[model samples]
Target chain A: MTTTEARPSKLTPRGRATRERIIQAAAELIYEHGVQNTNNERIRLAAGVSGSQLTRHFPTKESLVRAVIAWRADTVIALHKIPQLGHLDTFASLRLWADSYIEREELCRGGCSYGSLAGEALKAAPSLRPDVADGFERWEDLFRAGLTAMRERGDLRPQADPDQLTHLLMAAFQGGMLLNQAADDVAPLRDALDAALAHVESFATHPVPHDDATGGEAP
Target chain B: MTTTEARPSKLTPRGRATRERIIQAAAELIYEHGVQNTNNERIRLAAGVSGSQLTRHFPTKESLVRAVIAWRADTVIALHKIPQLGHLDTFASLRLWADSYIEREELCRGGCSYGSLAGEALKAAPSLRPDVADGFERWEDLFRAGLTAMRERGDLRPQADPDQLTHLLMAAFQGGMLLNQAADDVAPLRDALDAALAHVESFATHPVPHDDATGGEAP
Candidate 1:
């Protein structure tokens, strides 16, 4: 419920740019050092803003973190909007997505901000919950849109539930990233994606029976 | 690489109980606050030990975290040894695991301690990479063993590679956790597990035919 309510920019046009640069630095610091470990002073030093300036702009650490979460959500969720996914093979698109994920990993250095923040905030700050929670919901929508597009193009089984598949795909991708962090390697991500891609491809060769009952299928 | 090297309680039995209490307190604090964020002073306060007494028992934070990780490894990994997993229906066993995971989320409120430490450590300290990496490798191995045993029992696709499936499963689980954290809900984990269990069931029902390049219909 807390927010940066200040409507006025603290600095001039050039000063505004400086403010953004400082915010970016603070975000990076937050990503690198745990938010609790990172403080206004460290953020100021890292961002090259005066301690007074940092406080004037951010006022509180929560506001600073919220800004970062918004930015990250925008970038991570941008994948679904890239046109021409309609033409790409599912595996090709997934590989591209994987490569992009690698870029994100490098940028953050071993952890997704969402995962880290969610864990940290869950235990400490109850306020940040809404932002993180909302981000995931949006993420699911992004995937659902993409899968729906594929279904419309006949790349997916006619009876396939795009919404359900979206959940599954995102789940695996998220899990893969977590596993990659744990193993401190990317092989798990690759293996998981490869297995998933193969299954999607196999769906082309052998479709689930159209008349198959939902509940009584093999347990 | 820094070890705490606390002396085993050579003191009265009462002293041993106190030491254990102190260690447990430190673990909770470290999990709540980042390892670096938590200090001996705070730990002493939480544990009700004198600052000097806390220092006498455990000299460093790294050593305390190490102790927790070591203890967790022994206890949590032992959970993987449940036999006859292959004999259980995929749905039944998966539901059990999934439910346990949800329960964990409820308990931690934030996520997982092992995951949190790995994320924080890998980001801030490069030296801890080895410990974090080794720990996850152990986790992956446990998963691999389960998949392997199940495959041996004909509970998996004939050509399913246990290692590959293990990776996929791990990825899904981790990814789901991330999504769970982001959404502040259990849907991601639940949805992903549902897909995985469904995929296995779908796959087991239709094994791919062996190639007969010799122009003979081989049974």
Candidate 2:
């Protein structure tokens, strides 16, 4: 069946539970071992589901991968929406947001959920590029929403473009994570976020004082 | 056999030619299909080499992957070293370097050579992480060397850190390419590079006139 036709919303309560279990198992396996290595049999064993159940929920590997992408996107979106971290309208809040990502040991170690998936998807599953793209768009919108709020509040200069700034931050984040994954260090990520933040800060209507403790210089 | 022992330098002229052919074929396949999908048999077939020849050159997949990583790194380094693009000491030259990458249709469409390899290497070939890390370090040094020149010339502010700025630029380039691949568009890459260049420009001792035509605003 097509991914659309197999939507979880159409399933019964028990079926939905089974599907969630399968997706959770697959997501964990994919994150640990990547999409190519995580096969149906392993996922079946991990989820404690029978072969029939997996096929019933996700008839194709592509469908399962799409679910995992959606799952990762949801998890990231939820994390970003945490009350203290959601607001990006203020410079302090933005810095805090950047710090929150840098401080996530799991993210530093495992790489970004979307970024890891994007690489695999782009290489092996080109059809899913749009799904990954959608996830990024939603993620970007989260930042854009906050920056737009800053613009509306007169916190950002008239010439500053929130959309463009969001792209820069997203680039910093994705690129930094890739470097982190390669080098097995967090410094690249921190530097990237710092640079993007410094760029964002340069557009502030009333520039925030440089926090010497953070080691981020004024743009 | 270990990759070190199988070094191309140790081979005779014909053997070295054979090895180069295999690596060239594998690199093309890996870039097009990815590491997981490019198997030894396919590589042998594509390279027009017999099974024994392929096995002789690369006893294991990891060995072949390492060779491919080195090949891609050398190619990228050579491209960056083209006299016109090599110097990053000046603001104008830095902009040119960023533009050259953004204008490469193949990179935009197929994704970056190192970035694509980095993702697969980080996931499937943990043993090759150091190799990829070394490649990135070398790439970063290219930019760092130029920024250092700027610093030595008193063109950069005293407080500006060339090493950190190099990280930021690398982040923008890598992250922009990933976003470009996912979104199937070039604007994200352009926006990211523009933002990074603006950030780099911010550190200039005597600011270059903002090129209004490029749409990059002063930081």
Candidate 3:
């Protein structure tokens, strides 16, 4: 009843399915109830897996949390992988990225998965810091790559600092999501993203002016 | 052993002190361990209170969490009450407020107390939403008041929207604190606040141009 017997690459189709189920259940539970409140027993019950099966996949809650972080990182990165959000070199695409999060808030009825992890559980669990930090760094890398593209395309001013802007965008995003969840409203998220985007947009060379009267699409 | 006989106004001096001690202990414990992991027994042990004494002040753990939310709000608001931060009519005072939070991060070694509460435990404890929400609203009001003062002074353009800017600033703050705590670095928080203040500065009527080279004092 240990992972030693069945490594991920060596697992049978059914074994892989079972492991995925358990990890998904654990992620949902941790995302909702938090890592500290969640237990192996509850995850087992929720996943409808036997004790041996649970132990075979993830013997410890810490291991399971680490898996959930990887799992959630995939889910989040996949959202950004969509063609529009993937490049994020254009104003419309950046708005799409913001909208995607607002859509997620409507579905999850909570904050960003990463924000929840970082704000409470990650700090409390020192051992999990690297995993969480890696996930966030990957998130920042995505935006950095996008901004780099914008700069190369002459869409952004030559003076714009992509590294600093990337970090600023991430901070605004994490902050926006936290406030949105706490207030159970989307306005805060929208305002934060809009302001951050405007800041980024300010650095555009030959910027297209936004219509002041209609509050038209960002240029 | 419940608070059946003693009320806040009617409490003797000793009773008040004991209650404050319990609340202060609970706040620290919750801030450190979160509401889910920190239980009644731990609170009692940490506060050095007997079961009867603990129960007399807070009959349930939920009540204690609510009290901690209120107490932390008071602590956070008190920091902003300093004359410079109370009315952020000038750019200098806003930087002071932002810097105060950065100084706090160096000391606290965690995210904003309110941000942590909202991200995890408060969401799990649905019954405590109103209390936590009210606490956040009060924090927003502080910023709103300051922004309103700026508008009244003709420092901000007539087009400036204080209410929307208030919400935006709060979102950036909570978000920035979160990233800073997670990365154990101050750069993200600094970037976020500087970006937010720059956004506000864009609204100044008779703008003072900052000396770009020296990183001179904010006007």
Give the lowest summed-lDDT range of ten residues in model 1 chain A: A210-219
Model 3: per-residue lDDT, tens digit, A1-219? 233434778799999999999989988887877787788889999999999999988877777777888888888887788876657777667767776776566743567876786666565676777777778888888888889998899999787778767767887788777766667787777777777787788888876565454233233
TM-score of every model versus the real structure: 0.79, 0.95, 0.91
Better model by lDDT: candidate 1 vs candidate 3:
3
- Residue B137 shift from truth in candidate 2, angstroms: 0.4
What do the candidate models score in CA lDDT, each in turn?
A: 0.62, 0.85, 0.75
DockQ of each: 0.36, 0.66, 0.51
Candidate 1 lands at a TM-score of 0.79
Interface RMSD of each: 5.2, 1.9, 2.8
Q: Relative to the unseen true structure, what is the Cα RMSD of model 1?
A: 8.4
Positional deviation of residue B62's Cα in model 1 after best superposition, in angstroms: 1.5
What value does the lDDT take at residue B18 in candidate 2?
A: 94
Clashing pairs in 2: none
Ordered from best to worst DockQ, the candidate numbers read 2, 3, 1
Evaluate residue B91 in candidate 1 and report its C-alpha lDDT on the 0 to 100 scale. Answer: 37
Top candidate on DockQ is: 2
lDDT of 2: 0.85
Candidate 2 Cα misplacement greater than 4 A, ranges: A1-5, A210-219, B1-5, B210-215
* Among all candidates shown, the one with the greatest lDDT: 2
- Give me the iRMSD of candidate 1, please: 5.2
